[model samples]
Target: MHIGITGASGFLAQQIVRDALAHGHRVIPFSRRKGEPVTGCEPVRTFGPDIDLSGIEAIIHLAGESVLGLWTKQKRERILRSRIDGTRWIVDAIGKAPSRPSVLVSASGAAIYGNRGEETITESSATTSVGFLAEVANVWEAEGQKAEAAGTRYIPVRISLVFGKNGGAIPLIKNIFKSGLGGKLGSGKQWMSWIHLADIAALFLHALETESVHGPVNGASPNPIRNEEFTKVMGEILKRPTLFAAPEFALRLLPANEASLLLDSLRLIPEKAVQTGFSFRFPELRAALSDVLA
Candidate 1:
């Protein structure tokens, strides 16, 4: 398979590319830069609607502005526009392609479910969650769905909190716990759905290869943990004391209600993946953390 990946240099994209290459697939990395090389892949300069994707067999759209910083008005606008516009461009490119790719594995987020408390979130769950991140995810997935009109299988992977060694949120969380400043947010009862970097990468490949797997696939482990339990495991792994906690009021004081990202409870279930015979290497949080921290 010849795969075209947007945001190919990103943390998660890099892992996916490595896995794809290991599986004997040709990777074409789409980049905004004219001649920047993506290691071990064919690099293409993509800018605006005129972009060409002639022979690309599949596309993994992962380009977007990071949602980690303080959500000022400008930051919020950037986050929304980057996803909406970037997805729109990809759909347009697919429409114009001489031969449209068989599948499009675009990135979505578990935040689309919003603060669902203890409700088990699956691909079939209602996306009635209302908030900035939720809205972004909803619109982002909708835009990617447009590719289906061009005769492509569009699978929007609604990703959870990704745990990895070198990148994603784990490094920062590990650092905080190592410094003994780590603790649960709010009441610590909120659910957190997470996936190891390797598992998520493999899930993308599974979705790409499996024809029956369509629509929104939850990129999370079968076992979702509470915030308190996650904190406890992190402390145990790092041999640090998690004695502090970030209260709701203090978190809400941050710009643009960034507290929701931490406090929102989503007990996600990868029902589609499991039903389709996909296996997870690290289904438990403790084992996943041990491998990542090691």
Candidate 2:
């Protein structure tokens, strides 16, 4: 299969591209910037008009602005527009293509489930949260749905926090622990849904290859850990003591929307992925972190 990926330069997308190539699939990478070129793929700039979508069997749309920093009004618009406008462009290009692709595996987030306290959420769960990021995810998935109208099998992957050694949230958290400042955030009761980098990449491939899988798929591991437990695991893995804790008030100092990324609780479960026979390489938090750190 020939796969086209948006945001191919991104951390998770790079892994997906590598895996796709390993599996003998041709990749055409599209990005917002002209970065170092991918060796086996042509880097396309599609922020402007008309990108060629011909001969691509599948598309994994992952391009979006980073939602990690301070969410000022300007930053908030960029966060929302990047996903909404970027996806719109991709959907339009796919619609106008000489031939439509077989599948459209677009990126969404587990944040859509919002702060559902202790409730374990599946793909069937309602997106009831009205938080800023949750709203962004809702709109993002809606844009991906437009491809289904064009006869393309659209699968919106609601991804959780991705953990890897060099990238994703693991490195940043590891650094804090390494510096002896890692500890629980707020009440430390928030549930964090996370997936290994390898698992996420494999899941994208699974979505592309699996015919019966469609609609929203939860891209997460089966085990969801609480914030306190996650912090303790990080400390234990790094052979460091987690004595320091960040108070809720200190976190509130960040832009309210940005802080919500940390404070919000969501126990996301990948029911659809598991039901579709996709196996996670690192289903447990300790093993996943150990693999990355190794």
Candidate 3:
């Protein structure tokens, strides 16, 4: 199968592209910039609707600005525009292509079900939280729905926090723990829905190949842990003490209430993925951490 991917340089995209190549699939990376190479994949520089996607069997749209920075008004706009406009661009490009890809697997987030304290959320859960990210996710998914006009099967992946070595949130947390500054954030009672980077990549592949798995699929593990339990597990794996707590007030000062990433409780469940027969390689937090840190 020939696959087209955006955000080819992102941490998750790198792993997904590598896996796609190993499985005898051709990966053509689509980027906004020109002349940049993606190691083993074909890099196609495209702007707006001019993207050439002929002969592409599928597309994994991952282009977006990182949401980790301070949530200034400008930064928030960039984040919103990148996903909403970026997805619109991809959909428009697909509409104009000679042959539409069979599947469009676009990125979404669990944050859409904002701040559901202790509630287990599935793809069917309604959006209850009000914030920037919640609004962004709603818009992102809405834009992805446009791809269906071209008769393409659209699948929106509501991804959770992906943990792995050298990237994502794990390394930063590991560093904090290694420095003995790691502990539960705020009250540490919020539920955290997370997935191993390996499992998230695998879920992407599953969505790409499984025709029956359409619509919104939660990219998370079956096991969702509380913040305090998460701290304990990380501490146990690293054999370090987790005594320092990140007060909520300190995090609010960061961009987008950067602290919300730590304080908000989301008990997300991947019911669709499980019913679709997708198995997670690291469903347990301790094992997931050990593999990432190893």
Candidate 4:
């Protein structure tokens, strides 16, 4: 299977490229910046003729801006436009090709189910949060919906916090831990759906091959760990005492929109992925943290 990715340079997309290539799938990586190997896969600037249709099995759409930045009007526009416009371009290109890819594994986020407190969320869960993130995610998924209507085998993967040694949010978290500053955020009881980086990469491969998974799929582990639990476990692993806690008022200095990501509660479940006969590589939070943080 030949796979092409939009945001090949991203942390998650880079992992997908490596996983696909290792599985003997030909990968045509597309990124804004060219002439670089994103996770061992050489990335090209343009989505070329070679990637239009023939022999292309799957397309992983992960290109988007980091939503953690200060949501200035322009920055927020970039965050939304880059995804919506980029996806629209890809959808247009896919529509023009004689033969479209069998499956389009488009990227979304679990933020769509925003701040659901202690209630466990599934793929069918309703998004009631009026936060900026939920709104962003709503529009992001709509961009993929256009592809699905075009007769493309579209699947919007709503990913959670993917933890790996490098890249993703884990590196920053680890750095804070190494400095002996690891502790709870706000109340620290917020639920965060985390998956080991390896599991996320594996899930993409699994989705590409499996025909049964077509719509929205959750890219997460079965176990959703809480903020306080994660901080406590991480502190224990790093052999550091988590005595200092970041107050919500102090956290507002970084970025306002990002606070929602850091402090909110979301008990997400990977119901669709687990039901597809796909086994989790690291099902427990401790096992996942140990591997990535080791």
Top candidate when judged by lDDT against the true structure: 1
| Candidate 3 residue lDDT tens string, 109-215 | 88888898978899898874387788899999999999998999999999999998978877788889999999989899999999999999989999999999989
Estimate the TM-score of every prediction.
0.97, 0.96, 0.95, 0.92
Q: What is the total number of backbone clashes in candidate 1?
A: 0
- lDDT tens per residue, model 4, 1-294: 778888777888778787888898878788766666655554465643333444555788888888755788888888887877877777777777777777788888888888888998998888754877777778878877877766778888888899998888888899898898889999898898888888988888888789988788888899998899999999988898898899988787765466888888888888888888989989998988899888
**For candidate 3, which ten residues in a row score worst on lDDT?**
42-51
Instruction: Itemize residue pairs with steric clashes in candidate 1.
Output: none
In candidate 2, stretches whose alpha carbon ends up further than 4 angstroms from where it belongs are: 42-47
What's the lDDT for all of these models?
Answer: 0.91, 0.88, 0.88, 0.81
lDDT of model 3 at residue 294?
82
TM-score of predicted model 4?
0.92
| Candidate 2 residue-wise lDDT, 91-112, digit = tens | 8988898888989998898888
Off by over 4 Å in 4: 37-55, 252-254
Best by TM-score: 1
Q: How many steric clashes between backbone atoms does each model show?
A: 0, 0, 3, 0
Off by over 4 Å in 1: none
